[model samples]
Target: MASDSPVYLLLGATGGIGSEVAHRLADDGAQLVLGARSEDDLDDLAAATGGDAMPLDATEFEQVQAAVSHATDTYGGLDGVVNFVGSVLLKPAHLTSIDEYRTQIEKNLDTAFNTVKAAGRPMMRSGGSIVLMASAVSRTGLKNHEAIAAAKGGVTGLMRAAAATYSGRGIRVNAVAPGLIGGGENFASQMSEQILSSEAGRKQSEKMHALGRVGTPEDVAPAVTWLLDPETDWVTGQVIGVDGGLGTVRPG
Candidate 1:
């Protein structure tokens, strides 16, 4: 980050975790350029956070690049960028269609790729951070998560490689991998919520985490912002699990 009050571009700004991250940044006095698929949601979030809103589909490279440029152009420079863009698919490979898999890849991995490509040169100007959202399933085996797991696994790979590629330039890249975030008002999380629609499913999910509960937007937002913090600039190429130990522990 260039200064105390840096400019940031937040993709998927209307999502549950994304919205929380925006307000957290706003509280820290960071000027924001918010981008999301829905213009209406973007406007509402922008108004609430006092940020400029840009409607965009993150799977589109040009749109994402335009967003980066908008952030730099509007605020003079971009100090950080975060991609909260992702998808949730809970189906075995046998049940997943090609189109479904493609959509999954586009939503999670391609968005991350486009974001890193778009932000590289701009942030390279003075060095900044890029945080991406990954999933615990990418590292830990979770049945029926094949499609999403593969997509997010690619995100993890991108985060590390980009971190290596940009480290000398002082740009940081990292990811927050969460497990079963219980609530969110986004396309992806809504799909994820379906898995918990049943009491049996909900109880099983809660018990899957060693902490005896699922996570929330509040549980995940701060970690994203912390990685974006200039204070933690030295941290890079890492996947921090905010997963209630689901990715590492099994409850006894």
Candidate 2:
């Protein structure tokens, strides 16, 4: 059975989906330790959710370890962890620069690796859950998404391996792969002005999903929360798509 108040460490707590998940977890009676690269953002979220805040750079193993340590120390124990650290690079393979490829790997894959390694130690002692973020593009071919797909693909692979290795220790690992989510200000910033401003471009992107619309941060938060909950203990090593059928279906 799940604890009445599960202690969870949430990385990238300031992002669109992360923020939404933080709030939902808090409402669901989870004690949260919020982490992000920006101290100001962490402080703000900490205040809003009544959670402790830690400055974290998920790409660095030591920082990831420290954040996990802080969560366990502050809350007496850690029950779950959710990582929302990732980037989007809309460029074809040939057009993608070396730097862009490296950035995507560091932002998406490195963060997942560090989070799993650090969190696994404490979580192994007491059964817990870990959730990482992937993307629909990892399983589906999308134009101008080579770099992001590669990085998120690595994330999916990492999550599955970690889940298999640690299940014996009572650790459950899973991932949520979402489609293009709308209403993310930071995500919008990553897009070209033309894509953001063009009505045709926006409509085309929406039509890619079987739902006939883009997703939102709200669309993903519930799934993350469910995976973290102890009630879903039987589920692990799965890459559940909260992608509005984007990965499995094509709208005619």
Candidate 3:
């Protein structure tokens, strides 16, 4: 029997949006296994969320598989999984290096792939939810976003295909595609930070979103949390846009 309290494996749990999801899940009384490359950050999150900390490198299949195993082993079942592992690269195809392109694929696409591949084993038995972070740039044409767009486009495809492949087994797969977010490890450390650093660049980014400003990790957390909730079991194979109308709307 599945435990009344769901068990969730959060890859990249120390990142901006990931930490928010972890806290929300913890508040909802979900059992969590927090995974990330930094053991210290993971330990801190573990203390705050009351979850076990498992140091993880999401790009490696074995490590992701182990995290999945840890959750099931500790909690008796795995109910949901979300991979917040990603990267942001702002460069045109003409200027992007092959190594940089490959790194983007590895960090964003490969990590999400590994999460779907590994989490399938435990969750298939009792049915669960899986969410991967995607980007609005995948669907919209954004300048100098070549490499990351390609990778995130692959994530969009991977989610759709994996959702189809896993739906019958009772596992639901979804991706949340967010827009130009300003705060968090993702935006703070990446080219996004560089863009938001300059007044002209920041306003340009804000103008890109119909909402008239940039976004925060807080804007993204609830969408993921909602998908992970069992109450939304009927929802699957969908790409939810938490992009502040950036992907599909034109600003006035």
- Per-prediction TM-score, please? 0.96, 0.94, 0.96
lDDT per residue, candidate 2, 1-252, as tens digits?
Answer: 233478999988888888899999888778888889878878988999989888888899998899888877777778999999888878889999999999999999999999999999899888899999998999898888899899999999999999999999999999999987767564323433345457897798778889988788889989999999889999999998998889989998
Give the Å error, residue 242, model 3.
0.8
Q: lDDT score of model 3?
A: 0.89
Off by over 4 Å in 1: 1-4, 184-188
Clashes of 3: 0
Q: Which portions of model 2 show Cα errors greater than 4 Å?
A: 1-4, 184-197
Please report the candidate that would top TM-score against the real structure: 1
Deviation from native of the Cα of residue 92 in model 2, angstroms = 1.1
lDDT: worst 10-residue window of model 3: 183-192
Whole-model lDDT, model 2: 0.87
TM-score of 2: 0.94
lDDT of the candidates, in the order given: 0.90, 0.87, 0.89
Question: Model 3, range 1-252, lDDT digits (tens) per residue?
Answer: 345688899999988888888999999898889999988889999999999899989999999999988888778899999999988888899999999999999999999999999988778898989999889999899889999999999999999998899898899999999997777565223536878889998888888889898888899999999999888989988889989899999998
Two-way lDDT contest, 2 vs 3, winner? 3
List model 1 lDDT by residue over 1-252, tens digit each.
333468999999898889999999898888999999889989999998889899999999999999998888766789999998887988999999999999999999999999999999989989999999998898899899999999999999999999999999999999999988867566446756777879998899999999998888899988998999989978999999999999999999
